[model samples]
Target: MPAKLTILTNGSIKVEGDFEVCDPQGGVFNVAGKPAVFLCRCGQSAKKPFCDGAHKTCGFTSEVKASA
Candidate 1:
């Protein structure tokens, strides 16, 4: 399946299908064969680049909208 990314309202980015996640240094973060992944957007997750459900407590907000 083709990779798809969905930005959740005021939350993390939901990614599905075949995809690769990499760090700033070009190191790949293994997903362990998982079919879906949620990425941090509020910059509050202790697990940077991954969602730790911190947005709920961090008061993160965004007015930007994404188009399909």
Candidate 2:
């Protein structure tokens, strides 16, 4: 699938396969850098880049796909 990037409804960005998530403090976040990760968009997640289901409680929804 060449590493899929899916933006779910009222949820974080679903990232699969291979990628890198670097913190603002110059730190790389990776739990072995193998498992799939969900990045937060609503900014209400307790797990920072990872989603903690806080988007649902904040009524967040994103489904806009820009065409290239």
Candidate 3:
């Protein structure tokens, strides 16, 4: 299945299905067979590009909605 990226309101980006995550240096980060993944957007997660639930404490906010 193709991957889908969903931008959450006031939260991280939710990625579902098959996907590939890579670093700026062209190194791929292993997903370990996860069907879905949550990416950090608040820039507060100790795990960059992956949500660590830091938005709650960091006061990240967004009102944007996902469209079909």
Candidate 4:
């Protein structure tokens, strides 16, 4: 299975592949081979770590490159 990488405009890193998401509370959210994962970068997400589309309002953009 190939990993899917996506670069969003005015948003954080949206990774869609075999990965895991962990919070500061020691909470782990396993993707189990998901198709999309939004990572926070604006440092103002109410969801923390995970992006909740707050970047649209904050105008936060990521300069990440997509790779297969």
- Using lDDT, give the best candidate's number: 1
Relative to the true structure, candidate 3 reaches a TM of: 0.89
**Positional deviation of residue 32's Cα in model 2 after best superposition, in angstroms:** 1.2
Which pairs of residues clash in candidate 4, taking residues 3 or more apart in a chain or in different chains?
A: none
Work out how many backbone clashes candidate 1 has: 0
Candidate 2, superposed: residue stretches over 4 Å from native: none
**Model 2, total clashes:** 0
Inter-residue clash pairs, candidate 1: none
Candidate 4 regions off by >4 Å? 2-5, 24-27, 30-33, 61-68
Q: Model 2: per-residue lDDT, tens digit, 1-68?
A: 46788888768888887777788898988657466888898999999878898999897877767689
Candidate 1: where is the Cα deviation over 4 Å?
A: none
Q: Which predicted model would earn the best TM-score?
A: 3
Which lDDT values do the candidates have, in the order given? 0.92, 0.82, 0.91, 0.74
Candidate 4 or 3, higher TM-score: 3
Cα lDDT tens digits, model 1, 1-68, are 99999888889999999899998899999897898999999999999899999999999987668669
**Judged by lDDT relative to the true structure, which candidate is superior, 1 or 2?**
1
1-68, model 4: which lDDT tens digit per residue? Answer: 45565667667777776666777887888766567888887887898768888888886666765579
Candidate 3 structure quality by residue, lDDT tens digits, 1-68? 89899999999999988789989999999996898899999999999989999999898999986569
Winner on TM-score between 1 and 4 is 1
